[model samples]
Target: MIEIIAISEAHVESFHRALDTVARERRYLAFLEAPPLAATRSFVLDMIAQRNPQFVALSGGDVVGWCDVQRLSRPIHAHGGILGMGLLQPFRGQGLGTRLIRHTLDAARAAGMSRVELSVHENNANAIALYKKVGFVIEGLQRNANKIDGVYGNVILMALLF
Candidate 1:
């Protein structure tokens, strides 16, 4: 059974591995690969320090997916956060994304965030649909916002207001 739980320092390494696996796919996240381990560790630690919501999906003690919402640091933008999430290839299409996102968003709401936003590659229909299902609405589109492997792709901006 897979468990969706808040990320702690102990989970950082596994979470980093999962992040690298997804990012290396070069199809979802803006990152072509996960950042250096030290950077990822620092980011996760900062998120924890700031009380931002970050959760991981664990299967057999390994991170298989994650969801997080990072609130803007500026005072005026503190009410808002950027949401990000991903699942390992094998974990997709089984409702795990839905579960992970719901858990993270709930934490965000409880933490007093008023809005959550995300940008998704236009071709990621499943992710777009899942975002919509979770009450996120398309706010705008950026033309040719992402270029990967000599190919350009539009980005769909989405937001959910609490």
Candidate 2:
């Protein structure tokens, strides 16, 4: 069974440790064919300190995924927020991604956010499909938004209005 829970300081070190050698390696490879990611650990830790939510997906007591929800500028964009998430490759295609997004949506609504936005690389068909399944629609495409292996990659900006 999978479970979702709010991350705490107690989980910070392990979370960072798990991600340090794994997520960074994959993302770096995707972006630059590199094997290390600089500053990602510190960034995640700082986000936790700022009380930006870090949710963990667990199965049998092992962390399998995570999603973040943070508030956006107010007044002009009141009740708006941003979301970012990822699941281990082994955990993908099992509907866990949908559950993770739904958890973030619920949390965002409870925190007074009426809209959520996210971006996915155009090359990531699976992620785009999952987001669409959860009601996120592509609002626009940012041209040459990312450079992977010296090639420009586009980003699909998507949003879900609550």
Candidate 3:
């Protein structure tokens, strides 16, 4: 059985592995690979310290997906957060994305976040659709915003306001 739960220190390494797997796909996240383990550990610890919303999908004690909402640092923008999430290839198309995102977003809302935003590659139709289904709306499009492997792609900005 798959479970979605808040991230904890014990889950950091597995979460890093899951992040690396998705990032190596090179078709979704801006990261082509996961950052160093130390850096990832620090990031996760900081998220926990700050009470940011971060969750992971666990299958048999291994992380297969994750979702996080990072609050902006500036005092004026503190009410808002940036959302990021991903799942392993095998886990896609199984509604895990919806489950992960909804859990994280609910945590964000309960933590006093008033807005959550994200940017998706235009080619990532599934992600865009998922975000829309979760109350996010396209705010703008940046033409040729990303150039991966010498190919340019547009980026769609989306946001959900509470």
Candidate closer to the true structure by TM-score (higher is better), 2 or 3: 3
* TM-scores for all predictions: 0.99, 0.80, 0.98
Candidate 3 C-alpha lDDT tens digits along 61-156: 999999999999999999999999999999999999999999999999999999999999999999999999999999999999999999999999
Off by over 4 Å in 1: none
Worst 10 residues of 1 by lDDT: 5-14
Q: How many backbone clashes does candidate 3 have?
A: 0
Residue 159 miss distance in model 3 (angstroms): 0.2
Model 1 TM-score relative to the real fold: 0.99
The TM-score ranking, best first, is 1, 3, 2
* Candidate 2 local lDDT, 43-135, one digit each (tens): 566667756666888877766777887777567876777787777667888988888888878877777777888888888898889889889
Q: Give per-residue CA lDDT, model 1, range 1-162, as digits (tens).
A: 999999999998999999999999999999999999999999999999999999999999999999999999899999999999999999999999999999999999999999999999999999999999999999999999999999999999999999
The CA-based lDDT of model 1 is what?
Answer: 0.97
Worst 10 residues of 3 by lDDT: 18-27
State model 3's lDDT: 0.96
What are the lDDT figures for the candidates, one per model?
0.97, 0.72, 0.96
